[model samples]
Target: MSKVIFITGGSSGIGKSIGEFLSEKGYVVYGTSRNPDNMKNHPFNLVALDVTNPKSISNAIAEVITKEGRLDVLVNNAGMGITGPIEDTPTDEMRKVFDTNLFGAIDVAKAVLPIMRNQKSGLIINVTSIAGYMGLPYRGIYSATKGALELVTEAMSMETKRFGINVTNVAPGDFATSIASGRYHTPIFENSAYKENYQLNLDLMDAHVDEGGDPIEMAKTVYEIINTKNPKLHYKVGDFMQKFSIVLKRILPDRMYEKLLMNHYKL
Candidate 1:
């Protein structure tokens, strides 16, 4: 039988691309959305799932197992975006992003572990972001969420290996998607501290996403990782500069790298 694949946040964007690609490759693909009823004419199966809700996560996984008897691959792609100066972004808003981007992914992964253990095999791929590698201006919250997931994936990879389940993360740079519209933006308050710079960075971010590479590239990378017998703990998919920035961070001094990022964002 073809591998049964489960992808979160599959209604659109990177998740949708991954689901469609895998389905075409003959995998049994089940994608999740908060309101599956509203999404029509989708290629792969989409079940109602809200990752922030533990009960919803469990129900959706149960539904998948009931239909397929096994889930061979899980693409933990459900996440939201947030942008604002760290100080200006409300505490509750920060918590909300963490709930959805970090805790949500963890809960979904926890739900799938037992089933994969019993089957003696499975793969979990967390969709992180290139922004996670550094703290970008006005996008600090979004960066922290994905960055935390990256580290968690590392720890989970070590723990799950003995159980025959593989875990990894794919950090993609800006991809043409609906993320901009979906992300929370702390309004550019007129008299607030960071008015001019904040607005400029926001415009810059939109441009990057607007000119981003195709989501199909992310799908292809995920497909390649899924097929590997011993995939690495972390993978990055992006253009030369985007991926290289990570490398630069590793080799550069603390203040120097900070300076580089500040220059890039014109902060």
Candidate 2:
């Protein structure tokens, strides 16, 4: 039987690309969207799922398993983006992002583990971000959520290995997608302290996304990880510099890495 694959946030962006690619390769693909009815003519299956809601997560997973009898892989890709000065960003907004990015992913994994454990085989791939490796100006909260998930993936992998469940993270850099449009950007208040630098960095961020690599690159990377005998704990997909930034952080001193980022953002 072909492996059954389920992807969260699959109505569009990287999740949609992954689902379509896998469907074409003969895998049973089920993707989720908060408003599945709004999405039209999608190639593979699209189910209703709201990661932030436990009931929704359970129901979606159950629906997939009920139809396929087994779920072999889960791509935890349902996430939203946020950008703002740490000081100015609303605390409630920060919690909201954390709820969706970190806790939501965790809840989804929690729902799947029991089923996988019974089968004695499964894989969970958390979609993180290159930003997760380090804090970025105007995007600190977004970075923190993804960073926390990365560490969680590490701890969960160790805990779940005995049960034949593989857990890992895929941190992608800027990709040409609708993410920018959906991202919650704390207003650049005219009188706020960070107005100038914040606006500048916002433009820079948009430019990077506009010129970023294709989403298919990430989809192909996910497919490879699924087929690997023993995949690494973390995988990153992006342009050379985006991936290299992580290496630079390791080898360079703290201030030096900070300087590079400030210079790039023209701060």
Candidate 3:
């Protein structure tokens, strides 16, 4: 029997790629997007969902279960990016970012856990980012959201282990996606305190996106993780440089790592 996988944020980018790739691999994939009208006749089942809305998530999951009878995998891939200095960022925007990236994932997981626990088998993959493991200048709030998600994935993995459920956090580094380009931008020149640092941060992000790794490769890595009989707690996918950078960040001193990032981004 084909396994059923449910994913959020599947309208585009990495989530969309994963949905297509997995469906081609014979999985009964159900992907959720905020606007389902534009997703008609897609390769996979596209359901209308707004990650920030608990009712929307609950209804989508209930609809899937009603038709499929079982959900073997859940991918918390819905998220958005907000970039600006921590002090300059609006408090309401910061909360919105966390609502979608962290709390939203938590809500979806909570809704799906009962079904998985009852079935005594399932996999939960939380799509995090390299930012989750390390912080950057303009991405303070975004990093915090991902960092919280990574920690949640760790705790959830431990809690779900005995129930035959596998929770894996996949952290991809600087993938070539519209996420970076589509990030919410606020004019730092308007804020006297952040004016001096505004251009520097903007240039840094542009350079990073120019050299980002391929999203398709990240999608392939996700496919591999899903097919694995026993998935690991975390999977890092990206170019060789990204893997090396992560290693250096893990092993080097704080000052050294900071200097490396500064030099790499020329910030």
Candidate 4:
């Protein structure tokens, strides 16, 4: 029997690309969306899923398990982004971001852990972002969510190590996707303190995302991770400049690294 893989937020963007790529490679792939009918043309199987809802997540996974009897991989790719200065971002909005990006992924992963343990094998790939390594202006909430998820994945790796399970974090920098359009922005009024800087940074960041690296590269990376029996804990995908930042931050002095990032964003 073919290996079974379930991907969240698979109706479009990177999730969709990964699903199709893995399917072509012979894995039985199931992709989830809030509306399955709209994604019928997608190459992989479509299941209705709202990661934020426990019932929806359980139902989706149960549907897959009922037919497949086993889930070899779980890709927690369902997430949303938000932009604005952290101070200006409302409490509710921040919670909403975490609800989807952080908690939703955890909920789904929890639901699948037992199944994978029962089978005595599985892989969990959490689609995090480069921001998880460091915070970015105007994307503070988004960064916090990814950063939290990264830590969760790290701890999960340790806990699941003996279960014949593997977990990997795929952190792509500025991939060309629907993320910008799908993200929520904090409201800015004339009195807003960071309004001007926020607008400037948001526009520049949006351009980077529009011209960001190909999602196909990320798909290939995911495939490689899946094929590796002992995959690395973290895989960063994007241009050299973005990838270099990860290293630069580690070696450079705190103030110097902060200065470099500030200059890059023209803060």
* TM values, all candidates: 0.99, 0.99, 0.95, 0.98
lDDT of candidate 3 over 67-144, digit per residue (tens): 999999999999999888777778998899999999999999999999999999999999998877788877888889
- The C-alpha RMSD of each candidate to the native structure, in angstroms, is 0.6, 0.6, 1.5, 0.9
Local error of candidate 4 at residue 251 (angstroms): 0.6
Candidate 2, overall lDDT?
Answer: 0.95
**Cand. 4 TM to true fold:** 0.98
- lDDT, candidate 4, at 211: 95
Off by over 4 Å in 1: none
Candidate 2 all-Cα RMSD: 0.6
Off by over 4 Å in 2: none
After aligning candidate 1 to the native by TM-score, how far in Å is the CA of 92 from where it should be?
Answer: 0.4
Estimate every model's Cα lDDT from 0 to 1: 0.95, 0.95, 0.87, 0.92
lDDT of 1: 0.95
lDDT of 1 by residue, 108-183 (tens): 9999999999999999999999999998889999999999999999999999999999999999999999999999
Runs off by more than 4 Å, candidate 3 = none
Given candidate 2, what's the lDDT at residue 125?
98
